[model samples]
Target: MPEMNRQITLAQRPYGVPKDSDFKLVETDVPEPEAGELLIRNEYMSVDPYMRGRMNDRKSYAPGIEIGAVIVGATVGQVIESNHPGFQSGDTVQASLGWQTHGVTNGDGARKIDSSLAPISTSLGVLGMPGLTAYFGLLDVTNPVAGETVVVSAASGAVGSVVGQIAKINGCRVVGTAGSDEKVRYVLDDLGFDGAFNYKTSIDYEASLSELCPDGIDVYFDNVGGPVTDAVFPLFNLWGRMAVCGQISQYNATEPPVGPRLFWHCITKRLRIQGLLVSDWADQHDQALREMAQWVTSGQIKYREDVVEGIENAPEAFMGLLRGDHIGKRVVKIG
Candidate 1:
């Protein structure tokens, strides 16, 4: 193992969209694991929209990443040394090791991974938090029934892709929206979404939704909240359910964008909208991961990953993610 540990720290809180200057990469001697701790050589780390919220000073469901601190993230790695009884050298595990090539933990949030079952990197992508988010958000929160029309925004993304596929598994008709024509093809042709459109090129979202969801949207899995959501409000069937998983469109907004007020539609149509975080279903992660792994291995569910090589490029990868530059999950390959 290398003697130096390289880390990406928050240089400053971003005001709008994050810039490369917002992060500072620093190096230090790799430290030895103390008693009860394990030394990890991280291989893959996740960059997610939720991390943006952490960059800000305000607290959300989780604490914000303070300036000069290592950026918070999940990582999959191999144990280099172990003092903990439950782990040993050569074991593969997943942990919240942030944006670094090495980490030391007491195994509080870490979990052992069966690398033989799937690619070890998947513990940070499809078979990880993003996958769990899609599973619980759609199945537990929205509960779409057979023959129901299920619409997902950011449809070609990590969580959105899984959402549509699982909805199909449940016998629902899945419609999706992506930022590009290529993503539209992936959503419809590769992932088997019933219908998909490029929202970037679509002139009228309401008109597109009307045509795609003639039966009305019975379950809406929202990822980008903006005009797309505004367009969905008027087309919801009575007692429709919505799972508010993310708002990527508004993550970097300096000021909240003003749009049509649709609370009346929610009341009149009897819509049920609930915001969710994957952490909310922490108790169910083992069960969800097991089931998701089965679906993935059986080819019943498919996933895509946009991997950027090198830990030094993590800031660039994160910026690109905010710009909708990735097709599915965006992860940084560190070691």
Candidate 2:
């Protein structure tokens, strides 16, 4: 008898916000690697805001998850069987193996993990896509300079947390927005942001930004769009740069969101706003990873993880992430 494999598959395309019923867990025989392929036993799998977008049927940067397909996500795994020259049975690797306990891959899009540098899970968080997202989004896209005021939304999250710390490292006065007071404290105290506010309580985002960013926002790292962005626009300094990363605020909108039109701020303030995907800087990933690893290992950059145990709980974990129930990088530990 072969070992059993468990997977979470997309059961239905979400109409708005996803529900547990939208996902189905299925069991199958663990697959054997063919020649030139590797068999992986996934240890940690990521659940992120972008996965919400993928649950819809519309095509974006990546294709939508099809019904019954294993939900797409980054995974940290150990190679259990390998016929590929680049991998060995004992090697730990990071791959887009989705929401599964076992996967077989051709070694494409898979990278070996150096567990000595950091925990294997960081490969899915700080040193992985989220960290790189923060790195290139802030530095490459926005080019935040020293002495500037940098504000990041979702500041306690995987990407935004790193964004704030990196901005601080660059000598910028960093401000962050999170959902709760506890998250705000984590951002300000633990992550070293100069200022942070709970957006949920800060009913007037403009007032919050006005108080925190007295010099005006020079660089805006936007993770949650909508009202928060509307408020930030008015506070943009001349020649400000905005990195539009994720719009978790509008990811689950049943209808297109209507808000104040603020493009005039772009004209008057000469603001530069651009959307970003981590893969946009694929050519620079190795360099970024090396730098991020050093920062993380040396305590220059701090990270927190919200790990949910068991593959069976992945759906609930993902839903909780969407609801802002987790404080940091939300991942599922598959046993």
Candidate 3:
């Protein structure tokens, strides 16, 4: 094993969108694991929208990242050394090891990965938190029946892509909205979305949705919350279900977004809107992972990864992700 561990640390609190200067890449001597701990060599780490919230000075559901601390993230890595009874050297495991090439953790929250089941990198994407988020957000939060029209925003993205495919499997008509025309095409042609549109070029979101969803939307999986979400409110059928999965549209905003107060429509249409945190379904994650793995293996669900080659590039790749530069899951490949 290498003697140095490279890490990305928070240099400053970001104002609006994060910039290159906000992060600092530094190296330290790889430390030995204490008792009941495992020393892991991170192979792949995830860059997610939620991490942006953690970069701020204020706190949300989780604590903010302190200055000079390694940025928090999920990683799939191999154990280089272990002191825990449950783990051993060469074991591939998944844990919140943050943005570093090496990390040490007690066995408490770490999960051993069965690499033979799928590529280990998948533990950060389709078969990991993103997959769990989609499963519970759609089926548990909002149960769409067969023949229902399900609309997903950011449809070609990690969680959204899975949500659309799962909805299709359940016999619901799935439509998606993507940031670019290419993404729209992928959602329609590749992922098998019933219909999709490029939100960037659409003159009227309401008109686009109306054209695609001739029948009213019975279930809406919201990933980007903004005008696109506003457009959905007016088109919902009675007792419509909505899983509020993400609000990437507002994550980097310098000011609070002001828009149409569409809650009145929810009252009349009987819409159910609920925010989701994948951790909320932690107890059932193993079951969800097993089922999603089957879907991936059987080709019932297809996924892609947008990978950045090095840990040093994670910040840049993450910024691009916020700008909607990549499709599917964005992950950093570190070794």
Global lDDT scores for all candidate models = 0.94, 0.93, 0.94
Off by over 4 Å in 1: none
Show the lowest summed lDDT stretch of 10 residues, model 3.
53-62
Each prediction's TM-score versus the true structure = 0.98, 0.99, 0.98
lDDT of 3 by residue, 28-125 (tens): 99978999999999999999999999998885899999999999999999999999999999999999989999999998778999989888989999
Report RMSD for candidate 3: 1.0
C-alpha-based local distance difference test score of model 2: 0.93
lDDT (10s digit) by residue, model 2, range 46-72:
999999988888868889999999999
**lDDT tens string, model 1, 222-297?**
9999999999999999999999999989999999799999989889999999999898999889999999999999
Give residue 40's lDDT in candidate 1 (0 to 100). 95
Query: Which candidate, 2 or 3, has the higher lDDT?
Result: 3
